[model samples]
Target: MALFATMSMTAGVSPATAGPEQWKIMPLGDSITHGDGSSTQSSYRADLWRILYPTHPGLDFVGSQQSGQLPDTDHEGHGGWMIDDLRAKTIGWIVAFQPRTILLHIGTNDMDRGPEPEQAPQRLGALLDDIEKAVPGTQVFVATLVPSKKAAVQERIDRFNAAVPGVVAGRAHVSLVRMDGLDPDLDLRDDLHPNDRGYGKMASLWGAALGG
Candidate 1:
């Protein structure tokens, strides 16, 4: 599926800085953000930071991630955190950070757990609602969950991606970023996590989405 409409950054804000007015971009997700299966500096999130730092020149990007954390950022995304775990763990952290923009990549683990195939949308919707409540003015970039080469996992990812747009519907501050067709080669030795090249592509796509 295609991406959703473009959403504006939060208003009345200058570029981020080290001070109070600084815009903080938080990468909230599971192992992807943690750079699993790759070296720490080579992880996509780190690569993204390298790309974004000089480009933005004002924004202060911070990462709050734990390897195998659930709900991705809030709890633990690894080991298949369903929507329920997301609601419980991630909401508070987003609120506490009060970031201007949030880069959210989640729901992959949920597919692994084998929840009712049809329930992905509802769960994602609920997660969106919780995020809105927790951070009223935060600009949310909802990434289309990346595809795994594994047939069963990829099928579930497809269904989850389809459901993401509906969850963020009518939210002017939310946008769906399509990462589906960007990397077809897989480039992953594990057939799950991305290798350095794949991570570079992922970071590049996100940089494009952010207009970096």
Candidate 2:
């Protein structure tokens, strides 16, 4: 059967009970994570909630900042924020919520306006380092960026994506989610943001990672 079908089968085994106050899952990133282009403004978090909630009834999305239409709307996504910007906030957020899992997709904003876009991976590494220091046991999922329409930006994204595995190599609590398969012409609502369908695809990947 299909993956989601399997998820459905598994999900029915439990009743929804756990909430954001109990499970503390942080969705950390920029505009995409904030659901900027989606019609419902639900983002992947909504769909990811659909996929994981039934099985993880106690799962809670936690962050200081909240957006999207999800029941657990808490998240750390900021519009136009870059890796370094997030790095500055990560330690404090982790300390506050003490999340059980962290979904991280950042760095695209760095390509838009930064002194050195090429340094994104290094900056991502630093963010991960901060995350590790804050909460050693929390599971962290880092995603490669979805495709951008602009060729110049895509080039920087490609280089940054290529270096992600290296940044995640030694970290046992972290895993890489390759989000580069999105078709910019079809998946993007604008130059940088994913449309609803694209966000759904992202949610599927995240669900698969977490389910594993």
Candidate 3:
């Protein structure tokens, strides 16, 4: 529950000097954020940019890590990372990037490789607490994980996703965006990752959440 994020902030580009019209958005999550199943590996970030950039010309995606082939490839999407991993680094990334908006889609790994699925919601809440404390004004959008094909994994996913709204409740800047209607048999490329079409669907949902 540290209020201020303590980090050097020296490694990346200098602190953002965004103009009044510009908005820096950070996509913070796992491989889905990294564009794992997409052919272009741009993930939903690229498609999201395409959706929002025309109207919101200054919509900038910022992060330490880089992937994809798009012009704005920056993001904080780490593959195989859990909610706690993101929690540990959230403050540092916030301090470095100074994003005004954060898109968080996490906890898939915890559900996939865990003995305890019930605790993910609490961990997610803790991460949100840190984010709210680090920068209270920042707009946060929390999305439920996309569907999975495997019955056992999907069951855990269903339970975890079901608790997300409750986790995000009462956080003034945080909003819940449900990723429903994505068929695992059709949308997913692998067990858990989304294909290009699925990423497009995700981008559409994120775009709607951002009011684009």
Candidate 4:
């Protein structure tokens, strides 16, 4: 990842030029990261831009491609992507971008279409290991799956989420973000994706996890 992200114009102002961009933040996931529920294209990313940059100066969002209506149009969100898909591409992108940090929320597709529902967390662990291999010191914040409506889906989600902490524990440059209580009816745009308000909530959770 590039050291400095090309900052987008926000609140009618360009990025500060005090120095090169210090932090590169990548929102890597499935459709949720693709901004399916939010009209502003990843309400979490949009809201993160609106809220975080003021306090966390010189932070730039980086990715292989850009999306969203915001001036900073970069991310690695894909619709219906499974952990395997992410596993294949993640390291390459990490090497290309050399990001300082990555915000990862994946495995939803695996819950919906399981090759083996039990292996999701292991795949996640492998992905994290790949990141450490590719980027060495990059930080990763992995989110547990948010709430879902169906009983079976939620059960699978719980199983996958339950395994996440153990996989992340004792791991360098990786941590878990709990999403067990995030409401589906309240935040979800559909059975899966988060609505604008939901994405805002997601953004708040992510921001809080990032810890300035």
**Local accuracy of candidate 3 as per-residue lDDT tens digits, 21-123:** 7889999999999999999888998889998998888888999989998879999999999999999999999988999999999988998996577899999
Using lDDT as the yardstick, the better of models 2 and 3 is 3
Q: Model 2: per-residue lDDT, tens digit, 103-173?
A: 99998889777769988888898888888877788889999999899899998889988999999999879
Per-residue lDDT tens digits for candidate 4, residues 1-212, read 23334333333434553455578888898988889878777558988787778876678898876778875879999889999999999888888887888999999889988699798888888888888977788999999888778778988998888888999998898988886677877888888888888888888888889874
Highest TM-score against the true fold, candidate: 3
lDDT by residue (tens digit), candidate 1, 140-189: 88888766877888888888887788777887688888877645465563
Model 2 reaches what TM-score against the true structure? 0.88
Quantify all predictions' global Cα lDDT against the true fold: 0.67, 0.87, 0.90, 0.84
Query: How far is 184's C-alpha from truth in model 4 (Å)?
Result: 1.5
TM-score of each: 0.77, 0.88, 0.89, 0.88
Order the candidates by TM-score, highest first — what do you get? 3, 4, 2, 1
State the weakest 10-residue window (summed lDDT) of model 4.
Answer: 1-10
Give the poorly placed runs of model 4, Cα more than 4 Å off.
1-21
Candidate 3, which segments miss by more than 4 Å at Cα?
A: 1-20
User: Residue 182 of model 4: what lDDT?
Assistant: 78
Q: What's the alpha carbon RMSD for model 1?
A: 9.8
Give the range where candidate 3 is weakest over 10 consecutive residues by summed lDDT: 1-10
